[model samples]
Target: MAICKILFFLLALCIWCGKCDVFYKQVGDEVSMKCGVDSNSNIEWKFNGVLILTIDGKSGNRRKGLSHIVLKASASGDILKVPRLETRDSGNYFCRQSGKQHIVHVVSVFVKPGPVLLQSSDAELHCDITGDPNKEVQWLRPNGQTYNEKNQVIHLKSVTSNEAGQWTCLVKDDLKLSVTLTVVGLQTTAVNASKGDDIELPCSLPQSVFQRVVGGTWKAGHLPKVSFPTLTNTPSKILHWNGKDLSKVNFTTGQLSTNFDVTLKNVQSTDEGTFVCTVEFDGEVRLSVETTLRVVDKHSGKTKQHLGCTLFIRTLSFILYGLKLWIWIAVGASSVFLIGLIIVIGVVIQRNKRMKKRVRKLRSMRQPLTDKDYCQCINSSYNNCYSVIEVLQHLFF
Candidate 1:
């Protein structure tokens, strides 16, 4: 009893000085605290120096506290129950004798948060309860598994690809604290594919996170742009590959949200570039993956730039060979035609010379004797001289 008085006096003094033992409780929780005095004596309860309730000897000292506080006393000092604690419930609480003296227990209530958000890594979560520290706390994971870590502070030691979700901590009286943790970031992958072969750009969601993805889009340098719908079987496209109405690129989803692979049919050197996939998560977060497509050709094991010189050289040689053949054909035809023309001209010239010789001989034979010509006919120089008749005709005509 003396110890009870001392404790009650100390509690009253702390309340007057605005200091008391703290009891942390979650929201929507009922706190039943133990008292250290006799239950039949008159007891007084004060909050922040204001009289809240009093159990006098007239009321048999078995009365409860205020509408929010429950006091059920026994032969010894019983417990004081504060139900449905809220933020306003956090303050100095004092219990002592009303007029003569009863028993008192002082407690300062602190309300912990119910919902929290944590980043990817370098994070810690602390949970507190109003009861004993030796008792284990119930923890509910996002995966629906119950965990009893028995720890006041939990540390997310390492993080990869950024983890985020809802975590819960549960104490007695159906009280629950939840945290929404979100970690967002990006990752990259490298892929090599040969020209004219089909390639698949990998973009898959695990079973745990497949349902969380609402929509996504895929784009590449040479690939046809395609966007998948959160609903419906057909994909929305901007342009089809290979200049056809149908798209050579296909965005395929798994039967059960287990697979998401983009197929590029007949991949060419032009199809080599970075392919990006962006997925919308929970309508707020965007997760992306970048894949680099490296298309290779076995021909010359080089790019088209290097093959340009070889192709040019081959094409020039072929053209020159055809031109040479045509030139020879033309030259041969011209030579044949020129030889035939020269022969005909030579024959006509010889024929004309013969005709002129015959005319000259005939004129000489039919010529009337001219004096000079007759004298020349006797001489060797006048063998073909015109006769006198031809000379007279020439002179008369």
Candidate 2:
């Protein structure tokens, strides 16, 4: 039973040390790791299971191998230092002590190209890791902003100068690496040229980083994202225009320095958009500037956009004026009809009252009318009767 218990304890120890502690650092950074043991413990340090150093437990003395140029061991055998780390120094480090299990430390040193960009350019920053692809990656900006991205890449569209600073990459919320970004001003200009006329779009890098330009490109419309042309053995003096050879573009170079000013031979309406000039340096560094082109028709002496707007405005105004005049005319006709109807109705009501009074008088008169009554009726106008029907013979007929 005692032997069985010992075997179970050993199995548990192996399971406990199955996973290793991961550390992330950038190239040229230093790292220090610890061994979970005492100062006088008989610690044996190995890299990838190869014995590199052995420390004596009695005297606390350390013996390192010939490959220990940048690797340092503590006098107490409890700490190890790796300074000025490079890509080659990334691997698993093991600490084995007497009568104890192995402890593993995984070191990942990565290198990233620094991005020197122009304002209003699109860019993407990557947090590259060598080991543990499942590790969660996060980005922390200089302005106390955090982004928990699962893909380990942060895309910045239309990057401005305000976003330039040291950006830190956090892995598993424990490992951190920082990368610095530099932003420069991009000169912008608007050129208004007539269609079928020659126009120039000027673009240039900052004076500080101009001389290091190895290759360049001029892209029209929307700028591409990290897409560069294939370079030759030597630095390309000819700039790539619209993903094609430079023959199609009319470019002029300065006598002293390189200039990216492009002249359109015959500007057209299709050429009216943003044109971006990107200059490439060694180590995948790039800078870009942009300018806008506005095309106008030479015959009309106005842009097509302006002409269309003016036409629309004039037509709308005419329609509104005509509608207003028609509305007033309808209102006047309705008022005249209503007033005439009211006058006719009043005349009818007065005639009706006079007829009622004459009927009542005729009914009250005697059959044999007196001459005084007949004479009185003739003297008055017969507006209430159709004809003079006061005589008995006319009434009988």
Pick the TM-score winner.
2
Q: Write the per-residue lDDT of candidate 2 for residues 83-145, one digit (tens) a residue.
A: 676655555566776233332223342223336665555667877554434446777887869
Show model 1 residue runs off by greater than 4 Å: 1-36, 39-182, 193-198, 204-216, 224-246, 252-261, 266-269, 280-288, 295-397
At residue 250, give the lDDT of candidate 2. Answer: 63
- What is each predicted model's overall lDDT from 0 to 1? 0.53, 0.60
> TM-score of every model?
0.35, 0.43
lDDT of 2: 0.60
Q: Which stretches of candidate 2 lie over 4 Å from their true place?
A: 1-15, 18-30, 36-41, 59-62, 66-75, 98-113, 118-122, 156-163, 172-175, 183-185, 188-203, 207-397
